[model samples]
Target: MTRPFPDDDSATLAAHLRRQAEEHRAKYVRAQSDRADKFVTSPRRVYELIRAGIRRGTMPHDQTLSEQHLIESLGATRNAVRKALQMLAEDGVLVRARRAGTSVVHDIVAVHDGEVGPRAWAGTPDEGRLTVDTLEISRISAPAVLQRLLGADTDSVLLLEQLGRMGGQPLYLRVGYCMTDATAEEFSQLIESNHTEFPPISVVHERLFGSAYGGSDYVVEAISCQERAAELLDMPVGAPVLLRELITRNSAGAPSELSYTHFRADRVAIVGSTLATTAASP
Candidate 1:
């Protein structure tokens, strides 16, 4: 039964109907585009995308992740979503409780093969803000292992300990052994400034020599925490962690600095890549 409206009322009703129709059409078009985008991606790409998100700090620590949300936002299939979640869980980046669903315990790390300078890839703008707090800086005898690596007397190396936080949450514990002639006092300003790669090892190199480091070699593996690391990282002793042992090389290809960084397995994600030289995004 259609009740005839006054002329003015009819005009308003028609305009409202038109707006509703346009909105519906726009929503359908957007859904179709999202579907198309999802259909063209591979399973591997889905895994990488999830990893990329974690690296970009979008998947925050301890945040419950919804499978349906991931599927919808990523335009991925059910199987693809399940597979990605399983892989992440196995990688220690996520955990699934009995009814709580999957939750993030990982953050992203970009592994470009050089100093912490301009690199092949930059993360999306949402990447976590890392604040480094220098705990102790002392001119101490090098650890036995570092003494052998440095091939110099133990008395010369400077020890710098730091703790990294992302948005006030603990991220990593770093112990840097700098093979520089700079005094412990000289490194205070640099390390506290939180620049120069969590420790000013490179700055000392540049201040003494005229150029930057040649490169760095990283040996990464899964390890169980020891006393010091367990205490600072707030993890149980023998808890599994991702250990990155880095040796920074001078331009002459000689190792001048060494650092042991223990990253929280469930609170950090490491994404490594090689890039060809090209103009970066504007």
Candidate 2:
């Protein structure tokens, strides 16, 4: 049995790989330096859509919007529709009553993009300051994993990839997937027109599906970067990275989109806030 290389070959190969990764990262960053100004995420589109319905008399005043009706009409999950309703209610566009359900409070209220808080888009206040650049958009057959995750009956999907930055320094790479059917063309057009400034997948779901902007369920893991992920994050292949898989679902617990975001270990840090719980009475 002949050996593939000398005993020290493995160490040599590792060094070469690291060098290659560094070189690739340097080249990518340099090329993207001349990019234009970026923007933050918003769910203005969904808010507008519902507002239009109200003003157009399509959703008349005092009409209740049930969860099932919104899901079917807008293709959004219950949670997203609910959030939109809540935002509308706050703006005096709609109202929620315990026994009466959600009803239109007024005919029209213009809720602009920046008017909403961080909670509207499942992001922290700090994240609203980060710049985003659209990197890639494509249409492809839904992979088995996505099919299972999204519960999509269709075979096709729209994919959007973006890079987040702060002070012109790269931070993270986010990839999003949504099932294709009626919104395929709309998704494609939005990606083409507003890739960098486009809302996050959760907001996109509400806008496209006419659902409220619900948050996502995230699964975090520390994994070695493979070739594609390394290229996206400008990290060396095999370097340790943080992977966050998000499944954005509606109020009924049905998924609307699936996303996998990669963060360079050196460039990103994760922090969160939790509420304090009071002790139960004995």
Q: Which candidate is the best by lDDT?
A: 1
lDDT of 1 by residue, 1-282 (tens): 665566669887898889999999999999988777656245676788888788776887678888888888888887888888888887777887878789886555543343331121225342335666788888877667668876556566778788876656666888878877777887676554534333333564565434676777887799999998888888889998878888887888876677888887766555558769988999
1-282, model 2: which lDDT tens digit per residue? Answer: 876556779987788779999999998887655321221113354566776787556887678888677655765555666677777786655779898899876443221221121121325333444566667777888878678777766688778787765435455778878654546567666554433344655555666656765655676689998997777666779988777777776756766678887766543444334689999999
Q: All candidates' lDDT scores?
A: 0.71, 0.63
Q: Where's the lowest-lDDT run of ten residues in candidate 2?
A: 111-120
Model 1 global lDDT (CA atoms, 0 to 1): 0.71
What TM-score would each prediction reach against the true structure?
A: 0.60, 0.46
Task: Give the residue spans of candidate 1 off by over 4 A.
Answer: 1-49, 56-66, 69-106, 114-128, 143-145, 151-155, 194-211, 275-282
Give residue 46's lDDT in candidate 2 (0 to 100). Answer: 53
Error of 2 at 118 (Å): 10
Clash pairs for candidate 1: 55-108, 105-266, 105-267, 107-268, 107-269
